[model samples]
Target: MTNNKTSEVPVQDPGADAVSESVIQLIRQHYTLDARRIRRIYAGLGSRNWVVYTPQETYFVKEFISSEDAQKGKRSIEVATHCITSGIASPSTVANRAGEHLTLLEDGGLALFSYVHSDEQIDKFSIDMMAAAGVNLADTHRALSRYTAPGEDETDEWLDMDVAEIVETVDEILGEISKLDQTSEFDEVSRRLLQDRKVQLANYSRLIEPIRILTRGVIHGDYGQKNLIVDDTQCLWVIDFGSADIFLPAYELGRAAFPPENFDHDDWLDRGLSMIKSYALRGALTRQNLVFCARAWLVQLLQSVYGVKQHYLKPHELQEDLDLFWLRRGKATATLFESLEEVEASIERIL
Candidate 1:
């Protein structure tokens, strides 16, 4: 969901040099910052981030990439605020002097936040951290429940999508790849992966024909390792509510608990178990939630092909390595999808 399209705003610098003059003016006017330091930072999934320094405090600035629907931006910040008010340990979006969460740019939006200090970059988390993340997500789900509930039409938005149409999309992607110059091995691997995509996508549909009805709600859509940060005290601060949408909580839980990178890890099962037990401590997860996560997860991995499309077709918009990152994750997920029943039963054991 985060790896979708690109949006154009009136900005030039893409690196650590300096923010555009218009953005600087916006900062000065909206934020009332004098002569402090500002520098761009490396953040992905379609948003640009910066760290602003001042005499009293440090602040984090984020540039919303898409402005086509400004209401979406409003809803995202509202969700983030709701998450914080519900006692979730997340970075809070600070309102401007005029009491607005979002300051729309010429074609995009700008938001200022209280900077979260994180001294460590967690590559892999321990079981305790896993459980903590699970509990945090549960708390977040419960928090969002107060703001709004997802509508009935949105329940099948993910589940009822036609696999055949997705296969056709894959074919179009393949045809585009075939026309490329084929510079390196990544190009070759992409071609092979798309071939896998067409067949397995149909097979996946047949195997899980009647996708189970899932627990539906508006959630922190991209709740993965990338969006999670660890501070000096080892507390996990969930960030990035821009991709917030209607989704199955268990589907998201399954992806986080049994991610493809850790699917074959020796303690993968135990780690997932810890997460589930922690989440279910307050009975946030249902029996249907437990049973359908794997199937939904498989569908997500196969069908969420925007990252691949952006990387291959729209080359300059994303990093070159993103193709490999997504392709590898997709392949691993397909391998795990073959054992979907085992995964379902294993996770259901905690139920």
Candidate 2:
């Protein structure tokens, strides 16, 4: 479940005793900093890691769950760097130490990164911009498919596992979460998500299995505009490879199918068509494969349900996402799954 921890506004420059001091120190020392200022910006997926602001730059510092697991995460980032340099866009890694991606601070963990443009969500993203992202993402996947994981890759952790484990874990947290006096609605929402998840478990697994095995490569487990930056020149700079992996093509393609806004029905088929066209520019698009891709999109939607269930999202949030999710799906269903297929055909005919 999501950390319902009371919001503690982070100090502009918290001291060494703050949350991850040892790791931060190691990172600074690795950078050979004479000592200036280090500020904690936000907590990342891993509690031990953070988005840090140094005097002259920004970085992602990750403290290992333990030194034993250190190499696994470190190697993942190292491989991710290869993926980025190979053509995928990712936050550049400027340094590495102790087999990890960043300096190993005395406190714990490691650090790595180069400064990136600020993450301010655009009010409106042009179709051209999204098309560019689709193309970029496809090129990245194709490049990564050529390589295999390092000996210590952590990308395999979530593979071949049933959805039951995640559901059980989320269900176990519900009672404890409800004990907190936040609001009744959140608890209610959590409960319903749990129930919906119980029914959807088998369906999720079946849908995921085919694509998971078909498009196995270094997959970006997470892909969204939040981790992407479009500069003044419209060059898309992708960041945050913390969840890159070897997984399904459907996963990545489904993610690219949606535009930045809350999912909608109107023009989605056209949107999907454009997105796929961008991805398959020099490649062939088969009718059979695109149908599988449509199913993959549905699987991705259900995966969100799994996430909401596990994260204990508020009922209102779940409702909002569900509405958008179905809206997008509704369009695909209406088009008889030919939106993307038609786009491919149009391109083929043109060629």
Task: Compare the candidates by TM-score and give the number of the best one.
Answer: 1
Clashing pairs in 2: 22-107, 23-108, 26-105, 102-111, 219-245
- TM-score attained by model 2: 0.64
Candidate 2 — which residues are off by over 4 angstroms? 1-17, 20-24, 47-65, 96-101, 105-108, 119-126, 148-183, 191-215, 242-245, 259-261, 264-273, 282-287, 300-351
Question: How well is each residue in 156-273 modelled by candidate 1, as lDDT tens digits?
Answer: 6666777888888788888887887654676677778778777677676565553555667767777877677778787778887754566778777877777765655667667777
Clashes of 2: 5
RMSD of each: 4.6, 7.0
Model 1 misplaced regions, further than 4 Å? 1-21, 121-124, 149-153, 179-183, 207-210, 242-244, 260-269
**Location of the lowest summed lDDT over 10 successive residues in candidate 2:** 1-10
Model 1 residue pairs with clashes:
none
TM-score of each: 0.85, 0.64
